[model samples]
Target: MKKLLIASALLAASSIQQAHAWGQTGHRITGAIAEQYLSEEAKAAIAALLPNESLAEASTYADEMRSNPEEFWQKEAGPYHYVTVPKGETYKEHKHAPEQGDAYTALKKFSKIVKDDTAPLSERQRALRFIVHIIGDLHQPLHAGDGTDKGGNDFKLEFFWEKSNLHRVWDSGLLDRRQLSYTEWTEWLSEKITPEQAAKWNTTDPLIYITESATIRDTIYPEGDRLGWDYLYQHLPTAKVRLQEGGVRIAAHLNELFAK
Candidate 1:
């Protein structure tokens, strides 16, 4: 019965991946950065989003930064993004079915620090950079997860050949599906970016972005009792689309944030 229960739980958990909070298509870029906002690594992950002076310059900047990251990002990051979230708190959702941890609240808190001129330049710079990175994270379906799971980590499934957890799928599995480099993929996805996307991605309200991604979460995958290559095949495009959107939106937001 224990084994049976375990299997049953796995099956039930499998269904959870396709649910609204778990969205079916996964596209996560995992590194030291991923969802983290504090690590020096996180700041490094987003260096590509910073200003490049021109598209030609952007490519040059990306090339130089990736090739010689130590010098570039060290020169770029602020002190605040280096500090971890205060103890006993999380960016996780922990609330009733109707209401949860406020993502907007989180954003406002961070933004105040960024906008505050009195803060040290390092802190302010980190805050600005993190705001750009978090907006990208906020759009990922699982990041605005349902309260029961740790951004879909508890949910499990099989992808391609191996058994995997739902959160992991979004964290890297699906994003890996496209063999193309980020630049190639960005070109395909950005072509369709609408004026509406531009207007919407500019919203600095963290809660609003959370709600927006949460709504997007619903359209991402199949319901319960399903997850496999077939599902992945059908949904991987959406994963690419989200990453593409996030990358473009990142560029847009950074451009606007610094333009100010």
Candidate 2:
């Protein structure tokens, strides 16, 4: 029965092909974004790890990061880790089988691997870089969703004239239609952030981010079958809020990690 639901969900998600790309595109954006924000430690780590490679080579790696990040993880998987319950009880949590491994254990092991001097510089940089991006991804609601639908991937819906799913709406649907580049979006978002919000955003517990994303899952879907600019006008504020929060949280976590 569980397998049937997941299969059905994946089938549903496949019907609207564009939504599936978020997991990939997010990482691509993530890797590209890293070049813009790397700290000296991160830079040194990259330099040492890929001593002979040019920055452009490392930058281009984002292309493949979108293709299949798991391959890159092979050489550099340790630092940014995940945990999945290794057991038959995968039926737990709505049968959300651990896609990676035990997330808690993965986190601990990754933290250790990245901190240890023994880890390769390139590998360390990769792990750190991935952590920077993935943590933000995890906060994006759809990413933390059920395994079957591929995190809202299965739930077919429409936004305005285009047929889309909940995941795609959050991924870029809402943001893209605004006609703002990521940087422009970031800047616009940055401007509205109050000191109060920044202070609150700085605190711990990514679970809040995860929960925030999940809460928004249904909202991303239009009220009825078809939605249009009215929906966008109504929801654009929320979209801005999420994007702003993402940038703030991204910077917050990186600052905490790299703090001397």
Predictions in order: lDDT = 0.46, 0.51
Clash count in backbone of candidate 1: 1
Relative to the true structure, candidate 1 reaches a TM of 0.55
Best by lDDT: 2
Q: Which digits, one per residue and each the tens of the lDDT, describe model 2 over residues 1-260?
A: 99999999866543443332233333334344334445676556556555765332333243245334365434333222222111222213333324444323343344556667887866666555445554545555565554456556567778767887767776767667766555555455556778798667664355566556556654565557666687778876765565456545555555555555
**Residue 165, candidate 2: how far off, in angstroms?**
2.1
Question: Which digits, one per residue and each the tens of the lDDT, describe model 1 over residues 14-102?
Answer: 44323221122221221111222222443343353333322212222211222233642333321111111222333344333222223
Candidate that would win on TM-score:
2
Compute the lDDT of residue 33 as modeled in candidate 1.
Answer: 15
lDDT of 1 at 220: 57
